[model samples]
Target: MILEHRTYTFKPGTVDKWMKKYEAEGLPIQKRHLNRFVGLYVSEIGVLHTTVLMWAYDSLADREARRQAMYADPDWQSFIAEIWALDAILQQDVMIMNPAPYSPPV
Candidate 1:
């Protein structure tokens, strides 16, 4: 199993606005194509105006296929357009992780 961790850094003071747009337009599309939804988070201390998403997959190929499908979906494309209109995102970081031996299984 593998996990995909994504951290999105948004322009300062626009987190709430962007998050609202994502929740309304993006979450449903993600739910349809993404494999496992772990959690969504916002930074409060160290990195302000940042959002994080975590997802689990059977393998890297599975992750790639799912994401590709999502990107091709019309709904997802529109959501991307909406986000681009907001122009709030500054940077995005993605990390592919494997569970440590000592880590408990979900």
Candidate 2:
């Protein structure tokens, strides 16, 4: 299995604002398109004002297809526009991970 790890660092005090918007709007649209949703988290110590999102996919192709569909959705497009307008994010990091041979299924 493949895991997609997305980390978004929001501007100092804007994390709560961003999270509120995401939960109210983006979450539903994203959930409709991506099925292997894993979890969402916020940093407690090391990196303040950062959110981490995890998603599992069968393969890179599956991830691409699912994300492409989400991007194509009008609701998602509108949400992206709103997020950009909010200008709350400072940086974003994405990583594609492969499970270790001995690791349990996620």
Candidate 3:
């Protein structure tokens, strides 16, 4: 299994707004398209304005396909457009990971 880890850093004080918007709109759209939704979290101690999202997929190809479909959705497109207009995001980091043999199933 492969895990997709996405971390987004928003401008100061804007993370809450972004999270609310995502929960109300983006989450639903992603839930429909993604196969294994892991979780979403915010950093409390280290990175104040950052949010982390985790997703599991059977393979890289599966991740790509699912993400492609989600991107093609009009609702998702519109939601992202609004996010971009907000200009809240400062940076984004994405990583594809593999669990260690001893790691528990995600």
Candidate 4:
């Protein structure tokens, strides 16, 4: 499994708006249908007021395939466009990790 980190530089005061809209509209589609999100976080103290998204899958190929499918799908594309409208600039960085060793609440 790996995590996909998406950093969004939201316009001022857009966090609450984006968050509410995202949870209200976007999240249900992702969570119920795609199982596309594992975690989301915002920087409390950092250089970038970024939002990080973590996603888990069985393997890298599985991750790629799933995300690609989402990217291609019309519904996902529209939802992403809505999210993008909230950001000043957005960047994505993907990290592949080995988390099994330190997982499951030690």
TM-scores of the models, in the order given:
0.94, 0.95, 0.96, 0.71
| lDDT (10s digit) by residue, model 3, range 1-106 | 9999999999998999999999999999999999788999999998789999999999999999999999999999999999999999999999999999998887
lDDT of 2 by residue, 1-106 (tens): 8999999999999999999998999998998888678988999999899999998899999889999999999999999999999999999999999999998888
- Which portions of model 3 show Cα errors greater than 4 Å? none
Report clash pairs, candidate 3. none
What value of lDDT does candidate 2 attain over all alpha carbons? 0.92
Q: Tens digit of lDDT per residue, candidate 4, span 1-106? A: 5555566666556667777777787776666444346777877787555676666666678767766776777877888898776664445565666566768521
Task: Report the Cα RMSD per candidate.
Answer: 1.0, 0.9, 0.8, 3.0
For model 1, the stretches where C-alpha displacement exceeds 4 angstroms are none
In candidate 1, what are the lDDT values of residues 1-106, reduced to their tens digit?
8988999999888899988887898988998998989889998899888889999998999989999999999999988998898889899999999999887654
Candidate ranking (TM-score, best to worst): 3, 2, 1, 4
Error of 1 at 9 (Å): 1.0
Candidate 2: residue 94 lDDT (0-100):
100
Candidate 4 lDDT score relative to the true structure: 0.66
**Which of the numbered candidates is closest to the native, going by highest TM-score?**
3
Score candidate 1 by lDDT. Answer: 0.90
Q: By lDDT, who's the top model here?
A: 3
What lDDT score goes with residue 13 in model 4?
64
